[model samples]
Target: MNPYKEIENEILNASHILITAHKSPDGDSVGSSLGLLHFIERLGKKAVIGHPDPAPEFLQWLEGIDSILYMERDGEVLKNHFQKADLIFCLDYNATDRVGPEMQQLLKSTSAKKIMIDHHLNPENFVDITVSATEVCSTAQLIYELIEQSGHADLLSEKIGTALYLGILTDTGSFRFPSVQPRTHEILGKLLGAGVSHHLIHEQLNDNNTVARLQLQGYAMSEKLEILDSCHAAIISLTEAELTRFKAQKGDTDGLANLALSIKGIRIAVCLYEKEGKIKMSFRSKGQENPVNILAEEHFDGGGHANASGGISELGMDATLKKLKTLLPVYYKSDK
Candidate 1:
């Protein structure tokens, strides 16, 4: 049998299925989870989404989002689901630890068969079936391929298409990222044909911004943004106090690094924001020549796509900032 057929059979044979995405979930992870849930429902099966945390405010507008059980508040329910589930689908993230330690332990304890559908590099070997598409723009696109290739193209619906569309859109930087190929657009067209209403999604994602979020972003851009003229790089750092002043929500700083990258002559952008005593880092670059993942992996204990990746620092904010600056001159070689 084909690989997709085997995956389909697992879904068909399983009596109870559990779905999960990574912690600090973004549009791609959250979208893939909900999209898979809707697809599994279309297959006449039951699956529950057990996210490691609540969906950030911007994504709350998504339909069926309320049905998810978060590890933040639904600990008992998540445990119950894991205990009862015979199969689990891990969306977006490659490793179990990507959901964080508490959820990771729960997943490791469970005897359920785990399936991973991810578009990331260096996936671990914990899943029973791994559908790793490192070249795809997003896991949502991979999910679409799985559905289309499994002889279930008829099951595509507006709800499923909407969730997956959000995943593709966000993960691809609104389709401006290099990973987006002709096939990505073709899949998006199919989703649009299924009544996805792409315009509404674009509006919903871009138009919904809180006053505090706006103020915070403005403050960061005006006060915190700094240009490293020699390297064609930009840095934006926000302290915990600064974030508190603005009452920053989970995703208040989204797109900030990209905004910094938009500047003329800037080839790389790094945004470091202090949250809960840890500094979260967002690294972005303009092209393959300025890959930032190695910088993230070696310095910040994180890695992802070359153009876009994330890292975290246990050190204090100032120290992390210093480390980033120290590495910058050596890491990025600006062609321009």
Candidate 2:
């Protein structure tokens, strides 16, 4: 059977289901979860979203945001729901490990079937049903198709449209990323037709930044920024102390990678952040001149797209930055 058909069958049979995403959920994960939640509730089935932390206030405007259950280090409520769920919709991830150690244990212990819906490369084959279209821009687009396939298209309420639109908008970097497609624009038109307010969502997402965040951006530009190979590569690293000083939240580092790409001669951009004893790296490249995922996977055990990727490293700041300085030239030829 086709992947979409298989997922549709699973949804039809499931009575109680749990939907979740990776740790440090992004707009795609949170929006897709809420979009699915709205669609499921419209079907008269019981659906709930499990998130490790509260989504930022910018996203609180989406429907069913109030119903999300926040799970701590070892949340008993999430454990109970995981055990009772007939199925689990693992949205926007390739592996159960992405959900963190505690949630992974609950998932393994439960009898619920795992269904994966994602738009990432290198899918893990652990789930019972997998519907991954790496060519698609966002998981929200896939969820929209799932609803349409299941004959639930008309059930897409204004709430569902807004949530899904946020997923597409943020994942595509406000429609500036290369992933933005014509179909994405078509979907946006349909969403507006459904009464979803684009201006309000944009304002809520953009205007809610605190003064500390602005100061943090200034600090990053001043202290952390580095241009390598005569601006062929750019990098920024944020220490934990700097994050504390700036009151930087988990997703506050969202646009720092893009900042490097803004340089005229830059081909590759990297952002390294220290969090919980590990250095998290976000990489991006422009055009076809940079092999970003290869550099990340080889150096830091991470892989993503050519223009965007990420990985984690145990190598301390000085060492990691040293490695990036040396390795960047291997993948890119500087016009300088």
Candidate 3:
């Protein structure tokens, strides 16, 4: 029996549906949620999209993005939808904590049947139906597969196709990541057939950067980047003052960590930025030399994929940098 058959049945039975993604919602999370929203509406069912926080400004151009309720800003509206929802679809995240504390509590208290469609490792068993495919490139790919396999291909509109395409493009690093496969290209073809403009999407996501954002990137590379040649590691730290000086926005430093990773000898790249009184860290590594997720989980109290992970430290910027430098030798040994 096809697993998606169960998912289809659940959707058929549901009337009032609610969709949500993790906090600090990225392209994949927001795109998959909106794509699924369009899918649900095509089924003649009413669905509401919610997120723990607002999406980045770049994603606001997506169709139906304005309708997504931010749980942090619109608690009552989200709570009301949560109460009335017959089914909830959780996209792109595994754990309830990924939705933040208040929304996590609401999710736990809700009686609605939950469905999870994610492409992440170690999913928590909190949902009724779990479609956790870590092998897939992104949750958007899984959604496209679900729709194609379940014989609902005709329900896909240009808006839905564009959202799905954005998710795949960004999450796979514009088809540069190893996770991308031939099937990903096939899906891209289908999305293109559905009228998604690839060039426009690329321009919107990448070319629409502000001058302040470019200045922030320049300052980070020149002034903040620190290299450990012996360990082949690079670290970048940005203080709140620096961010304010450049008028940094939510997505300003989106791909800044990758800049460090691009260095010739840098095997491990770490970006630490102060935000809201906490030091937020993003770890990126090349190949399988070092599993950044393990290091992040063990020391930084956070985890994600092997190559890419994020964590937070309550300590100040200086202390966090010192701690990271101290641990660098342990993870990236001189011999290795």
Q: Which candidate has the top score in lDDT?
A: 1
The local lDDT score (0 to 100) that residue 262 gets in candidate 3 is 90
lDDT by residue (186-251, candidate 1, tens digit) is 999999999999999999999999999999989999999989887899999999999999999999
lDDT score, candidate 1, position 151: 94
How much RMSD separates candidate 3 from the native structure? Answer: 1.2
lDDT of 2 by residue, 1-336 (tens): 556666766777888889988777788889999999888878777788997777765677676788888677338888888888999999998877777788878777888898889998889997887888887889998888887776667888888999999999888878876777898898889888888999988997888887888788888888889988654888999988889988887578877888878878777889999998889999988764565888887888887666788889888888888888887886676663
Which order, best to worst by lDDT?
1, 3, 2
lDDT of 3 at 117: 98
Please, what are the lDDT tens digits per residue for candidate 3 over residues 1-336? 687878888898987889999999999998899898888788787789989999888888999999999988999999999999989999999999999999999999999999999988999999999999987889999999888888899988898899999999988878877778899999999999999999999999988888999999999999988998878899999999999999999988889888899988788899999998999999988776677988899999899887888999998999989999999988888666
Q: How close is candidate 2 to the true structure, as a TM-score?
A: 0.93
Tell me the TM-score of model 3.
0.97
Worst 10 residues of 2 by lDDT: 1-10
**RMSD in order of candidates:** 0.9, 2.0, 1.2
Clashing pairs in 3: none
Best by TM-score: 1
C-alpha lDDT (0 to 100) for residue 264 of candidate 3: 89
What value does the lDDT take at residue 171 in candidate 1? 96
Reference-based TM-score of each model = 0.98, 0.93, 0.97
